[model samples]
Structures are given as C-alpha cells and as structure tokens.
Target chain A: MASTIAEKIFASHLRDTPTPGDAVLDIDVVMCHEITTPIAITDLMEKGMDRVFDPDKIKAVIDHVTPSKDSKTATQAKILRDWARRHNIKDFFDVGNNGVCHALFPEKGFIRPGYTVIMGDSHTCTHGAFGAFAAGIGTTDLEVGILKGVCAFKEPVTMRVDITGTLPVGVYAKDVILHIIKKITVNGATNKVMEFAGPIVDRMSMESRMTLCNMAIEAGGTCGICMPDRTTAEYLWPFIDDKYESVDDAVKDFKQWHSDPDAHYDSTITIDVSDLVPQATFGFKPDEVKDITDIEGENVDQIYIGSCTNGRIEDLRAAAKVLKGRKISRNVRGILSPATPSIFNQALEEGIIKIFMDAGFCVTNPTCGACLGMSTGVLAEGEVCASTTNRNFNGRMGKGGMVHLMSPLSAAAASIAGHITDPRKYLQ
Target chain B: MKQFGGPAIFLDRNDINTDEIIPAKYLTENSKTALKPFILEDLHLEGFDPQSDELKNAGVIVTRANFGCGSSREHAVWVFEVNDINVVIAESFARIFRQNMFNCGMLAVELPKEDIDIILSMGNVDIDIDVTNGVITAKGAGEKTFNFTLNDFARELIQAGGWLAYADKKY
Candidate 1:
C-alpha cells in the first residue's frame, strides 16, 4: 500500500498488524517538562502507577518557568526532580542544564525518524521535523505513555501542503509557516497529519524545519512532518554515527520512512511563497496574520525574540544580523532567550550575545517562560509586544496586553523601530 | 455512561483557546479544583463575564468553532470539570481538548454548523444530554432535541471514568 510517512510510522509502531480504526501504538519517546509533567506525576503516584516504561526512553526538562518562578513552580520542578531521580532517568535536565524541551531534546539527538513521541506540552510536535509521528498529548495520555509505552490514535489521514516558490529575502521559516497558517486558518488540519513538502521544505535547514513544524498545533494539526532526508541524517549523525557508516548511508536507511509518491491524502494544497513578505499576527489567534506592511508602525512596548518556535542558533543569527551595530528604540524593552544552554553558550561564543546586549536587549538564560507569560518579560496591562513566540492569544503575554507574532528578524527590527517594522529594510 | 447537562453559557465566539479557558498564570496551581474560580477568567468574549451569575451558574457551554485551540494543557478541561461544567457543545473543538474532555469523563459535543445555529437560536435554554443515546435536549422556550456523535473510543473513555481507569482494566 502507498502510505504517507505519518501512516508508515503509525503502522510500524502498532503492536498488532495495522487496523482500520483506533490503534494502540508504542511510544518511542515520552518528553516531559516541569509545568505539565508534575500534574501527571502526581496523578500517576496517586494511582500507584509510578513507574516508567523505560527510563532510557524518557526525557525530562524544566524549561518553563525555570529557576523556580514561585513556590508552586519550584515545587513542580522539585517533583519532576525527585521523580526523575527515583526512576534513575539519566536524560533529565534541570534549570542550568535545561533549555526548552522541544529544542533541547532534539539537540541531544533524542528523537529520530519513524519514532512516535508524545508529551503533555503542545509544542511537542516540534520534533516532527525529524520525520517522526510526534503529537502533543494531554495528561491522561501522558500518564498512559509513561506507564505502558503505548498511545492510542485513529487511523492516520494526511493533508499534503506543498510549499513551493522561492522564499523572499528576510522571509524566514517563521514567515512561511505564518503564511501557511493564515492560508489554512486555525483548525484547518484538525485530527490529521500535515505533510509539508515541495522544494521549499527540502531546502530548509533542520532548525528551519523544526520552526515550521513547531506551530503545527496552532493550525490544529496533530503532527506536522517533513520527510527525513540528508539534512535530517546530518543533524542526527553525531548520535547515530556508530549505527551508520556515513551521512549518506544514514539517509539511505531513512528512505524507508518516506511516503510513496502515490500515497493518499485527505486533501492537497499548495502555497507559493515567491511573493511572500515578512508576516505578523494582528489579533488573539495565530491565524490573524497580516503582511508587515499592513500593520507596520504600530507602536510596540516590548520586543521578545525566543521560544521553541524560533529560538535556535539560526534564529539568533537572523535576529543578530539585523541588530548588528544598531540600538533598540528607547521606548522598547527587548528580551532574548537562546532556547538551550548549548545554544546559549554558542551564542555567547559567536558574539551574538554581545550584539544583543549592546543593542540594549536583555539576554536571559534559556527558558520557555516569557513566551507563555509565566515569567521574564511579561507585559503589563494594555501593553503591546512584538514577539517571535507561537501563540498571540489575548493576554498570552499578560492580561490586557497585546502580542503581535512575527519572525526573529522582524522582532529585532521592531525593537529598533519601537513598533512593527519590516525586517527586509534591515537586510537591504 | 455519565450523563450530564445544565444551563448553557453562550460564548458566541470562535477559537476559545486553553489559555483563555484557564490562563497560563494559573498553571502552577497544586490542584485542579483551585482552577475553579478562574475558568474563562482571561477570555475576552462579548457579553461573557467569567464571574457573572450566568457564567458561574452555567452547566454547559455552547460556543462557536475551534474551541480550546491553543496549548495542550488539560487544565482547560479541568477548569470546566471543576466548575461543574460537564458539557461543552460547540461547532468543533481542537483535537487535544476534545480528547482531554473525555479523559476527564466530560463531554465535548461537536455538532454541524447548522445544528449549532439551531441550538444557539434557542437563547439561554438549559440542556440535557443522554450519553448512551447521543441526544441533547433543550429545555424551556425553543424546546428541541438534537443528535450528536461521539466516537466509540471517546465514549469508552467517558464510560470507564477516563483513561486511567480504562488502562487499569485493559492494560
């Protein structure tokens, strides 16, 4: 049968031969972070199911509200700390060693092609950039996954989104994804896998692909996937080096997870990015996107450039390129997080942190805090922000505060302009 | 089956996300019940007051499409469950929120747009849901009955008092 990559992965994980409807498939990785994992940890402990399927396959981090924002958050982290210690989970990452779980786990080569991963956090779909069937699940599913190493899902259906055409200068992967979400509306891909393909996806760096897939949930997609290829093999090569002779050999083996040319899709759509420009959101929803020109010059009180969505090295480089030898507008409070300690150290070593600090931006340790308004860089009432994070839901940054979602480059440019500004101007 | 229905709180907008449903600020709370008073506290829907008697007294929520759209936190569902809002009938729900509802032994009823329109037209009517029969009845003024669909797995979850119990029995 001609199967899409998502279907192939799902079928491969099932204990029995694939069935037509709801199938229980084994979970390869159960990623957890402090805020949500503690709830599951509490529940599992209460129910006498305080056991992990495999400690080696479990990865935990304390990225959200790190350094113990409050007593509650501190306790949450401590619970995860004790639980990981009790289980002898070697991959557990606490504050200083932690980054955002989505960015940190993949950086550690914890995810691979054809794996089925679940995490209580929604952005867990970020790992699907590696050609895995990764979905953000709820607490109950998280508990079941931790205990039994399996999860239930309906038979797979896919929507093939072929993003073709040349990406314009200053229009990065964040813009491309924002464009796609605006075209498809939020919930356009509900209950289905979003298969991102075409030349554009093929050319994207693995970081760019992760940025693209990270917001799959914003579009109500169960998972967003790119077929594993040379880029994927190269990104994972350091960890899988002994298993494969070379990157080419690893790429050849990954071909088993690719979709057949004739695979069935519930729907097919194509997005041409040739004329695309830098995009930013206008309202509470992720789909409320507008071209930068349409909303430029709206004064922004804050500018934040980080999150699992666009907080990697590439994102920092893009933002730094615009911020070099420039100062942020006096009215704007700029904040930058590098996603992980490794990315943080790399940014410092590359002088990116110096560029940001000199540009009057506050560089914080890697944490998912400010992105969700849990800590650091939270907005006051009636404030407006230009952010690189995913959701811009009303009060997402803070109650009565407005957030305009944009790319890292655009966010950095907005910090200079003190409002929403086009990043292409800086590039030129 | 755990049957439930109540006076419906009409949040007439779309894309009611988890953040608005429970807010990220309260995510650190120790227990789900601590989330009760804060349900829909951050949602800025027209004519919807989170603290109003209409909201506090609501047993069901009839909202527009793509409800519970952001953040996979089950706290959104827990907030509703803690508030005794056992049912949310909408045009559609974000995938994870729907599953989370069933995992909590709650009902997230997705009706067709036309059916939703009919229900909304009934004004502030109370509702009664029959889980086994999959029927929703509007009580008082615009008295009407509508059939909704719940997939087999979701029904089983609700029947088994959520995923944990189901796992205990099967796994």
Candidate 2:
C-alpha cells in the first residue's frame, strides 16, 4: 500500500500498523521553552512524575521573554532552568545563548527527516520543513511526551498543495504562504497535514522552506511538509555527515520518506504564483490578506522585522538589501532582531548590522520579543505596525494595537515610507 | 460518563482564537486561577462585553466554527475551566484545542452546522450535557436536544479525569 510522508513516518514510529483512531507513537524530540514548559514542569512535580524520557532528546530554551522581562517571566525562566539542570539536559540554552526555539533548534541541526517532534508552542510545525512529523501540543501532552517518550495522535491524513509557477520578483516565501492562507482561509487545512510539492517548493532554499512551513499552523494544518531532496540533505549534512558517504547517498535514503505517486490525499490544491506580488494582512485574522497595492499607504507607527517565521539570516539579508542606505521615516520606529546569536554575528560580520543601525533601525539581541507583546518595542494603544511576524490577531503586539503581517522586504519598505508600501519600489 | 452544562453564552463568530480566549500576557501567571478574570478579555464580538455579568455566570459557550484556533497554549481551556465553563459546543474546533479540552477532563461538543443553527436560534438558553448518551438539551421554547459523538479515546480520557490519570493507569 502506498502512503503519504505523514503516513509513512507514523507507521515507522508506531508499534503496529497505524490506524484511524488514536495511536501512541514514539517521540524523537521534545522541545520545551520558558512560558509553557514551566507549567508542565509544575504539573509533573505535583503528580510526582518529574522525570524525562531522555535528557539528550529534550532541548530547552528561554527565548519568548528572554533576559527576564519581569519577576513573573523571570520566575518562568527560573523554573525551566532548574528543571533542565535537574534532568541533566545539556542541550539547555540560556540567556545570551538562546534565540527563538524554532529558529535556534533547526540551526543547531536538532531536527531531521522522518523524525517525530513535539513542542509546547504552536510554531513547532516549522520543523515539518525537514520532512519530519512535527506538531504542537498542550501541557498535558507535553508532560506525557517528556515522561514516556511518546505522544498520541490521530491517524495521519494529508492535503497536497502544488505550486506550479515561478515566484515573481519582490514576492518572498512569506508572501506565497500569505497568498495560500488567503486562498484557503484560516481553517481550511484543519485536522490534516499540508504537503507542499511541485517546482516552486523544490527550488526554495532551506530557509525559505522553513518560512513556508512555519505558518502551516496559521492555516490550521497539523504540519506543512516538503519532500526531502538534495537541498534537505545538504542542510542536514553537517550533522549527519558521519552517517552517509555523500549528499547524494543521504538524499537517496531520504527519498524513501517521500509519498508514493499513488498515495491517497484528502484533497489537492494547485496554485499558480507566476503573477503573485507582495502581500499584507489587513485585519486581525491571518486570512485577511490583500495585494500590497490595495493596502499600501496605511500609516504604520512601527516596523518590526523578526520572529521564528522571518528572523533567519536570509531574512536579514533580504531586508538589508532594501535598507542599505535609506533611512526610515521619522514617524516609524524600526526594530530588527535576527533569530539566533549566530545569525546576529553573521549580520555583524557582513556589515548588515551597520546598515540597519545607520538606517535608524534598532538591532536587538536574538529573542522572540515584541512579536507577542511581551517586551522590547511593544506598540502602544491604537498604534499600527508593519510586521514580519506571523499572526495579525487584534492586540497581538499590544492591547488595542494593530499589526499588518508582511515579508521582511515589505517591512523594510514600510519602514522607509512609514506606511505599508510595496518592496518592489525599493528593489528597483 | 458524566454530566456538565449550564447557561450557554453564545458568540456567533468563527475563528475565536486562543489570544482572544485569554491574552498572551496572562500566560506568565503562576496558577490557572490567575487566568479566570481575563477570560475572553480581548474578545471583540458585537454586543459581548468582557465585563458583562452574563459572561461571569455562564457555564457553557455556544459558538461558530474553529473555536480556539491560535496558539498551542493550554491556558485557553484553563480560563474556561477556572470559570466553571466545562463545555463548549461549537460547529467545529481546532484539533489541539479539542484535544486540550479532553485532556483537562472538560468537553468540547462538535455539532454540525445545521444543528448548530437550531441551537443558536434558542436565545440565551440553559444547556444540559449527558456525556454518556452524547446529548445536549437546550432548556427553552421547544426544548430541543442535540446529539454529538465522541471517539472512544476521548471518552476514556474524560472518564479517567485527564491524561495524567490515564497515563498512570496505562503507562
């Protein structure tokens, strides 16, 4: 019987053949961060099950409200720190060393093809780009995963999305995903895996693929996966270097995880992006998107360029290309956070950091701040922001504040104009 | 099998996300009770005031599709649990939110759109959930009752009073 990648991974992990109802499958990685992991730790302690399945497989990081925002957030970090120490979890990343979990974990080569991963945060789906079965879970499931090295999931079903056309200039992966989300609405992929295939995805860089899969949850998808090819193998080559003779060997092994041509799908969608342009969200929901021309000139009080979704090194390069010498509008406050310390260091080495600062952008240490309104550049009441982060939900940045989700290139253009503007103008 | 239901607070909107159910700022609170007062604090539905007494006393919620659609935080369900709202009947629910509800020994009833239309028509009615029989009855004119189904695993989790108990027994 042929199977989709999701089904193949589930079958490999489960003790028996996978079925329709719930099945307990072994977990390969259990990711924990400060805010949500603390609650799970406290719960486990109360239940007297304060132990982990495998210390090495458990990666803990404090990135959400890092450097300790307040006593409350400080306490949350402290709990995670103590818990990591208790478990001898050497993979724990603390202040000055931590970045957003999604970006940091993948950068460290922690995720791989055909692995099963779970995290307490929704963006865990970002790892699905590696051809893994990754999903977000609640604290109860988190506790069970930590304790038993297992998680229960419904039988896997997949929705195949075929992108047939080349991405027009000025359109990034973020805009492509925003376009897909707009086409599907927010809940269209609910209860199913979204498998992105076809030429466009096949040509995307690993960074771009992560960006595409990161927003799978925004569309209510359990995961968004790309077939593991030579690009995927090269990205994971450094970590798996010892296991294979060459990248081609690794790709050959990964080909087994691909869905067979006759594999079943719940639904299939074909999107042609030959004429796609830069996109921006208009309202609270992510699906409320519009062509940049339709929403341009909407004045923004802030321009934020960072988050697990668009905080990687490539994202920085894209924004820097547009902001090299241009100063931001006086009315707009520009903030840029590279997703990881290594990315920050790379930007500094390449003079990208100087370009942003000279353009009046505030370059901060790696942290997932301001995206969720926890700290560092939060908007005031009634303020509007052009952001590279995911989710434009009302008050996502701060109470009564509005956010327009767009690509880093678009965000850079908006910073210069102090409004939602097209990045193509700056590219020219 | 157990029974849970009471006055239903209806919000006829789709994609009622976790951020609206409980804002992200409250996730740092030490206990689940700290989330109670802020339940639906950021929710922006017409004619629904966050400070309304009706919300405070309501024991159930009847809403449109995709209830709890954002964020993987379990706090969304905790807010409802702390406020004694043990059940939420909706057209459909996001996968993780529905599972979280069952993990906390609460119920998330998924009814079809047509049946949901009938229940939403009964304005401000009290509801009673018979978990064993998979039934929800609205105490209003016509006294209509709706049927919902739960998978055997969900029923087991509810009976065991959550995953921890179930794990204790099975693991």
Question: lDDT by residue for model 2 over A1-428, one digit each (tens)?
Answer: 99999999998998422235777888999999998999999998987889998999999999999899789999999999999999999999999899999999998999999999999999899999999999999999999889988888888879999998889988999999999999999999998899999999999998999999999999999999999999999998999999999999999999999999999999999999999999999999999999999987998999999999999999999999999989999999999999999999999999999999999999888998999888887889999989999989888899999999999999999999888888898988
Candidate 1 residue-wise lDDT, A384-416, digit = tens: 999999999988889989999999999999999
Runs in model 1 deviating more than 4 A are A16-20
Backbone clash tally for model 2? 0
Error of 1 at A232 (Å): 0.5
For residue B22, what is the lDDT in candidate 1? 85
The stretch of ten residues in a row with the least summed lDDT in candidate 1 chain A is A14-23
lDDT of 2 at A118: 97
Tens-place lDDT digits, model 2, residues B62-153: 99999999899999999999999999999999989998999999999999999889987877789999898898889866699888898888
List candidate 2 stretches off by more than 4 Å.
A16-20
DockQ of each: 0.69, 0.69
> In candidate 1, residue A372 scores what lDDT?
88
- Candidate 2 chain A: worst-modelled 10 consecutive residues by lDDT: A15-24
